[model samples]
Target: MKQNIGRCEFSQFPNLSKTICQEDDISNYVQHLNDLSSDFETRFEDVLTMVIPQLIINPYGDIEETDVILQAELIGISTN
Candidate 1:
C-alpha cells in the first residue's frame, strides 16, 4: 500500500495533499483510489499463486480455500 501511494502521479492531483483537499477534486481522488485498489488486488492474487503451490506440496497437505487466504495474509505481512 505504501509502495502504491509512492507510485501515484502527484502531478495529476494538483490540489490534493496533506495541507489541502479540494471538493472539486474529490472524483479524481476517488478514481485514483479505485485504480490503486485494483492494482493491489492483482498483486495479492499473484502472491497467492506463488504461495498456494507450496502449501499443497506440504508432507501433510490438507489445504483449503480458507488456508490459502490465511497463508496469503501472513505472507503479505511478513514481506512488509
Candidate 2:
C-alpha cells in the first residue's frame, strides 16, 4: 500500500479518505501516511524484543511447549 501510492493516477480519489480528513494535495496525503507508518514503527519498537510463544500463535502446531505457567496462561487466554 505504501509502495503503490502515487504510482498510478486515480480517476477520482477514494471518497472515504476525503471524508475522513482534509488534504488538498495527494503528495501531502502520501507524506502523512509515511509519517504515520514511521510513528507506528517507532512506538512499537519494544514489540520487536518480545519473544512470543509459538503455542499462542498456533495451538495445534507441533511445538514442545514445556512451561506449565505458560500453558496455564494460554488456557486462561483461550477461556477468555
lDDT of 1 at 36: 85
lDDT to native, each model: 0.56, 0.63
Q: Which ranges of candidate 1 are over 4 A from the true structure?
A: 1-20, 48-80
**What does the lDDT read for residue 32 in candidate 2?**
88
| Model 1: lowest-lDDT 10 consecutive positions | 1-10
Indicate the worst ten consecutive residues by lDDT in candidate 2: 15-24
**Across residues 1-80, which tens digit of lDDT does each residue of candidate 2 receive?**
64445443433557544443433455676888899989988999899778887775787554246476666666666577
lDDT of 1 by residue, 1-80 (tens): 33333444355445534444454565566678788888988989877666556544662333343366576665565467
Q: TM-score of each candidate?
A: 0.32, 0.52
